[model samples]
Target: MDTLLSIFDVKLAIENLPFVLSGLPMTIAVAFLSMGVGALLGLFLALGRGSSYRLLRWPTRIYISFMRGTPILVFLYVLYLGLPEVGIELTAFQAAVIGFGLNSAAYIAEINRASLNSIDTGQWEAATTLGIPYWRTLGGIILPQAARIAIPPLTNVFLDLTKATSLAAVITVPEMFQKAQIVSGRSFDSLTMYITVALIYWPLCIVISAFQERLEKRFSRYVNE
Candidate 1:
């Protein structure tokens, strides 16, 4: 009970919240951008991995393997530091978006590939019989179905990305975690400030989880029925 913080302390944590909330817009922008970039690149990577051509397949396989196998923090450093040597200068926040998005793509690609594989072989044959191009068949026939199968894993990846945003503090993106650190360092109320940030994340996670459930139900209803 002694460690329990007071209402004044918690209120102090939020009173000057506008500055912290300003950083929130950047956090949201990074997340949505990450999801968009991640999903598109992941879709192609998944397709390439599933391709019949050795040239197309092997490289993507290696790329996905490397990304998935490595830690994202390591990836972040390489992109932020190593890329600068090659004339790529991303601001810290930009680098975070790119790194987290790329990391997410690797996992999402695997999820998509697995979902695509789960479809009956006959669906491909049927699409071919209808004179649909292979790519069209994939887009119109397969991907929507694959999307349903991919939802749970995709949701999990988004959650991971959301949490992983804390790492932005390392490169100084001034996100929630970084804000907490700044506040704690100033007030010496380390526990109280971090507790507020922790509180913020929990509700966001729950909302995303709830949406994921609704998406799962909507998709399942179509296929299962």
Candidate 2:
């Protein structure tokens, strides 16, 4: 216990807590911003994947395949480092957000596609028989039902995105992990800083998971009725 305490440097961790926490806002910003982008892009990708036109379907399929196959770290490097070679310089934050957003969209697209597909064909038929336009049927009837099925998976994606924001440190985005890295370097105690950051992430994820449970229950109630 004494040896562990000596290595961990609890006093240093306490002292640097504020500095480490200072980056929390940026971490949250990157996560939400990336999620927003991913949600929008993923929705369109899902729709495209389901479209009747081969042109739309094939391209979306290729995009999803490529994005899913590639490592997100490489994508981030391409955006932040490789793009500069083509005179397309972006700030670290911009690169992080765009990279994470694009990568996450592939996963979200699959979730959206699966959710949208899960709605019964009878619902579509009934809407069509009622003289509802395709868009109206999709928006007014199918999507709401599909949303209930989607909430859980989408929340999982959001949770993953939130934690994955730590990868932004590679490009020098001043997020929580980056701050923790700074603290670790300054204090010469990598284990404690990394553990502290992990502990911080644990509570944040727990809160998000609790919120997911409430959201699932709320949506499930609507479905039950």
Judged by whole-model lDDT over C-alpha atoms, candidate 2 comes out at 0.92
lDDT value, residue 79 of candidate 1 = 79
lDDT of 1 by residue, 1-225 (tens): 544655338576777466566667767777778888899999999989999999989999999999989998888888777799999898888889999888889898999999999999899999889899998998878887888899999999998888788888878887888887887788878777777777777888899999999998888864875
What are the models' TM-scores? 0.92, 0.96
Pairs with steric clashes in candidate 2: none
- The per-prediction CA RMSD against the true structure, in angstroms, equals 2.0, 1.2
Instruction: Give the CA lDDT, 0 to 100, for residue 147 in model 2.
Output: 84
Winner by lDDT: 2
lDDT of 2 by residue, 1-225 (tens): 999897687888889889989999999999999999999999999999999999999999999999999999999999999999999999999999999999999999999999999888998899888899989988888878888899989999999999999999999999999999998887778999998899899999999999898988887865898
Q: Using TM-score, give the best candidate's number.
A: 2
Give the 10-residue window scoring lowest on summed lDDT in candidate 1.
Answer: 1-10
